[model samples]
Target chain A: MAKRQLLLLSSSQLHGYEFLEFASRDITDFLSKNKVSTVLFVPFAIKDHNAYLKKVEKPLNQWGFKVEGIHNQENPVDAVEKAEAIFIGGGNTFRLLKALYDTKLVTAIRTRVLEEGVPYMGASAGTNVATRSINTTNDMPIVYPPSFEALKLVPFNINPHYIDAEPNSKHKGETREDRIRQYLEEKDSCTVLGLREGALLHVEGYNAVLKGFTGAKLFVRDQEPVEMKIGEDVSYLFKDCA
Target chain B: MAKRQLLLLSSSQLHGYEFLEFASRDITDFLSKNKVSTVLFVPFAIKDHNAYLKKVEKPLNQWGFKVEGIHNQENPVDAVEKAEAIFIGGGNTFRLLKALYDTKLVTAIRTRVLEEGVPYMGASAGTNVATRSINTTNDMPIVYPPSFEALKLVPFNINPHYIDAEPNSKHKGETREDRIRQYLEEKDSCTVLGLREGALLHVEGYNAVLKGFTGAKLFVRDQEPVEMKIGEDVSYLFKDCA
Candidate 1:
């Protein structure tokens, strides 16, 4: 049976191997420990495809895992099927969705990650794909497809690159915290995770724990964040009833 | 003297025109009335280049103004100087931004619009390019640029296809009304136009009035929407503050 685990990292270089650096530090360690270094980079969704290609190429090989780069936007369904561990980096989720929809790869990744369980790891947009909805990313409306439900790797939503209120803007605006609160005021029972860099959500079986970071606030409407720590069990994080 | 009047439309087919049928009704009428028989579509940001190519082919010919397409992504910068009345259509603003950023068309368009006084118009993402910050756009993050600012055509943020709340989602989340309010609070002092389909801001000397359709609403924080009609004038919907 394939081992199913998700490594959703914040944007910080992780050691162990370099080719897979743009992902979280904790993620690379998970890969190192599992002895699964070979990886695939999805470039169709990113703006700096060439930059990222160079970023991941060397480190992946250094970590003793073969690295593969897929550039088939026109026929991504094929690229996705042949890959082992799939990493969806951060960029524009809608644009990524549109590209995937255009190439018909959304369902392929869904099948591969959910059904086949080939170790899914994503950072910004990647972590976003794990959620049931992605109405809260920070980007532009290059286009709007009527219905937008994400990859839904997990049941709740994640607000990656979650930031604290800036001193200058704090006096006037609502941070992601405030925004989710508004979302909460309406849907009093939605689980939202506000993650900062160096954070990773490691899921195996019925447990999830925040790994390798701090200041990553987890929020659900109506309830305050249950303070999280690296190496601590997270069954308590999602234990409360909806 | 160059004609400074610009006709910005919502996304759709151009009605009553023999060609370019899939444009907003409001824009087509403005074109018909202004006797503008031709238009040039800058498709630097669109996914399907062929569909856009055919969109402007027919009506522009019918209007008797010869039309051509200038794809910045496919061509060099020297061609930007030859263009006139460049109407950037609505598609994916992020894609367009990517293309513009890639081709340096963002600087070219700003030079053309501001320096040469090219009659400029945009809808949707096209509309977004006219703002100081594309950050307010409700699209997904497939990529992360350092910033989400745009051309600042009117020194205001535009929310086209201004969604309020889906009937099913109406009571379940932060309504669109509440979201922009949060942006206002964050921005503290900036004008935001929740321009509904068919509603537009026609700018002339000291004259920015809401014209065309009636279904639109404009909001500044904590203030009621000041309605729009064919010939009513309003000042900074948020008053002197923004």
Candidate 2:
């Protein structure tokens, strides 16, 4: 099998920064290193695909890459199959997964990224679908897809935009840590990677590295979460992945 | 058909208060007015149902009602059918709904509450399941339930512990309003009730009333959300309910 390539970002835009500004250099480096020119963008996560495409195109265009939305294509699967690189933007996780299933692009995109070695980049919801399932997503169930099963391009699930509990807040709701803990309570075998904002994970075949500005929380069943900073090799997480 | 009696609370406990302290009066009154003495408690939302029952029993017992956990019963459906009243406490929504389906208590509880007029009280996750669906819940989707389709004892969906956006916050995740709007964007026909902390809805047959300390926001498709305060009669929301 070809070396699977994936770039999963916790978020697209950071506070006080332009869209994708926080990771502009990392994104460009990933694409350029892969020798990518034209990019296929999946904007199905948001309600208006065209508007989402426009927002994404401005940055990629400045980076000297032509961006095309999969929604604009006659056949989305064909677009994924023929694309040099694929970038799925963030919005609502359920909506994105539903559209992927509706357009029959799950298998096609999975095959392209894992087997054909097509460079795949994802932010937030996009990062969510690249995992085994979207159960740990913070997005509401605005729409119910056929299943919570995702692309499974990676072995572990990613909780993007992961935040810590406010020290002084008096809210009675479960904290982010509590939610992730509860997730482990239900599915103990699966691991969850809580990617803080401005954090990203880069994977090439089984070699995964924690990248970007911020740190991440690695959650395993029945164990204390390990704090991982940027520039750390997290490839050991893929030891059990086939 | 018998009068459907229900009291759905935004949360079981308010910040800085003991469990159920904030809504203790409302709960007691609702049960008292309905002439209920024995309450069957559905503690399936939490992992340890026995511990959940112990916490809830303290408050209800002090109010002079016998509290029994459905988990201790041989058949959960039989427990629901024979109860004078039913109370579901707060926890994870997905786990609660899945347990309801697993125990075959969905139809049983619906019949007991709607057809037999058994007084039903729910807090947080419990309040979510009392509605048409659990799609609006704030809880993480730790486990995949058979469906998002809920009890439907009420026509409109209830979003318990609904909070507004932090004005000065830098987090880019979608706000509560954005989530509800997104839900409407997907399913335009459904309505969502955003119940703030310390808020609740009391339903008697076709009459519904907003009660407790705080207020609620009512969302309709393509319409501005209306602010509803405590002591307001929200019976109009049940007009379309059969």
Candidate 3:
């Protein structure tokens, strides 16, 4: 089997940028390099599936790829199998995972991405599903899936839109770091990649790179978080994930 | 049969305040008025149950009440049955609910609080569990309980440590308001009470009052969030929750 290709993004929009504008170049380049022509979009995370599809369709269509939402397809699983590339949008993680389980698309997508080597792109809730489990997601459990288990395409969990503790904030709620630490306490073997806004992980099989304007934070079960520089090679994450 | 009495606090410690200090007056007054001689403390939210017990016991003891941790009991169910009052400290909601389910204490505590009329108190994760489910909690999904369904002592869900959008902040992550809205989209009948730090709800059977120094925001399905004043009667929440 060929190497699995994936682009895991923290968010679709940056602080002041338009929809998918910040990562537009990287997204288009990844698709072009992979020779992907048709893309299947998963819009289960948000409430308005049609609106989400239109939001994503315009951009990918402008980039020269025919974009189709899986929700609109007559056969969702068949769409996943035949698509040249797949893109999952962001919203509530629990809702997204529930939809995936309900459609029985988990196995179909896994076979397509991991085994058939179809390129995959995910942002926020989408990025969450590429990981081992949704255990590290920041989204509320608005709904419950059959299990917390997710696609283990990436051995470790991905915490999208991760923010650090505010130096002088008065709010007593748990900081992003505190939440990640609590997660580490519960599961010993798992590692979390904290992807800040505008950051992403470009993965090609066993090789992955922390690519963006900023760096990422890597958190292990019992160790302090280490910084992954803009161009740092994170392939070792794949090895440590298992 | 009598009015179910409960104190659901957003946090144990407010910003720069001593442990449970901000709510000391209300807590002490509630216990004293109820003539609660011994209070059973459930410290299942955090891993260090012993430390948690010590933190809460110091204050309540000075208030002239005997505080014992449920974890230290030979029979937890019996402890709840015999206890005059119950207190659940906060940390991680998922961990707290998992422990409650693991020890088979959910039904035990529910019976004591709802049927036997034992005055119950909760902070943070403890507060989250006193509601319909832990779905509105801000804590990470570090662990999964058998179900997200919690003690429905209160009609609506409690979102403890609720923070509003920062006007000038550049973070692209979802605000607390955004999360609660998503939750409403999934479960329309549910109403979420956004309890900011230091704010709390004092529920007396079917009638609940929003207490504390600050006001809370009440979120309903397909409607604008209503700001609940400190002394506002929130009995209407009971009708909308079911």
Candidate 4:
């Protein structure tokens, strides 16, 4: 059996940078180290698959990798089976998950990544689907999927583009922290990783490390959230659970 | 058949006001005009139904209405049948909807409000569930309900606690307007009312009016969002749709 390899990004674009520019070096290194040449891109998260493909192609092409959108293929499942690497971009999580389920790519992608060792790269909503469920997303529920369950490539959930509450703001809605706490109230057994912007988690086999510029927060059932610094080994979070 | 009556508030609390205080005058007036002597409260949105019931009881008791929690009733559906009015408080929309479905209150409340004309009052999450669907809510998907199809007490959908983008913020997440647009992309035929905090919609039979201190934004398919004024007669939005 092949060991699973993944790179989950908090966001594709950081403030004051081009698309995927903030994590360009890390993305290129991950693909190159995995010896990947062609990348199969899942662009269902956004409305326009063609336009989304173009946006990603320009950057990966500059990095010497060919990109093909899975939407263009007749058999998306077969495309995932034969792909050297898989990359799912950011957009609406609900839309992304619905499309994945509609096109029957959830199980296909899950098997290819976990069993075949196909490098899986995801940003924002993509990173969200790689987790146990899309239960902790920040995006609106523009569409309803068959289920909130996702690929489950990882043991825990990810709240990408995670932010802290503003102290002086007058907004009456729940803060990101409050929302996460509400999730824990219902799913007390699950672990949630609040991935800040400009951050990525690099995983190899059973080991996972927090990388990039910013830090991440680990939220357990009843304990206070502990902040994790960059380069910290977070593989302990991958332990098996019900 | 009796006419359906509803008062869907954007939020229970405002920036510096007490819980449900911002809409106190309208709430009291609506209940008073309906000759409602008791309000059967749905406290399933929050974790503690007892605490939620107490919080709402304080204000309604001052306004000369007896407040009873549906959670405390022997049969929740039977409670709705015998109640003078139904009031659902704010918290998590998903949890509230799930509870509504779990306890078989969706159909009971819908029939009661639309057919039996039990006056319905909802704040935030409560407001979101009274519409055609809960797809437009701003709350996190902390729990997955059996379906996103809500009570359909109204002809359209409501996005409570709707807010605009910060002009100078560096956050890469989608703005409130952007999210509503995405929803329109998926469900183009549907109309959405973005109810800002401190605002509400007062409905009587076929007539609906926007009331409160703040205004709202009306979103239609393939049209620019129209800024609605307080006290505006928005009955046209109640037109029948697919």
Task: For candidate 2, write residues B1-242 as lDDT tens digits.
Answer: 24799999999978877889888888889999989889999998999888999999998899899999998999888888789999998999999999999999999999988899999999999999999888889888888888899998998888899888889988888889998888888843388899998999988888889998889999887899999999999888876433
**Candidate 3 residue A101 C-alpha distance from true site, Å:** 0.3
Check candidate 3 and list the clashing pairs: none
- In what order do the candidates fall by lDDT, top score first? 4, 2, 3, 1
lDDT, candidate 1, equals 0.59
Give me the candidate number with maximum DockQ.
Answer: 3
Q: lDDT of each prediction vs. the true structure? A: 0.59, 0.90, 0.89, 0.92
Better of 2 and 3 by DockQ: 3
Report how far off residue B157 is in candidate 3 (Å). 1.1
lDDT, residue B108, candidate 3: 93
RMSD of each: 17.2, 1.3, 1.2, 1.3
Candidate 1 deviant stretches above 4 angstroms: A1-3, A12-25, A32-37, A72-74, A167-171, A236-242, B1-242
TM-scores, all candidates, are: 0.51, 0.98, 0.98, 0.98
**lDDT (Cα, 0-100) at B142 in candidate 4:** 86
Model 4: per-residue Cα lDDT over B7-81, one tens digit each: 999999899899888988999999999899999999999999999899999989997899999989999999999
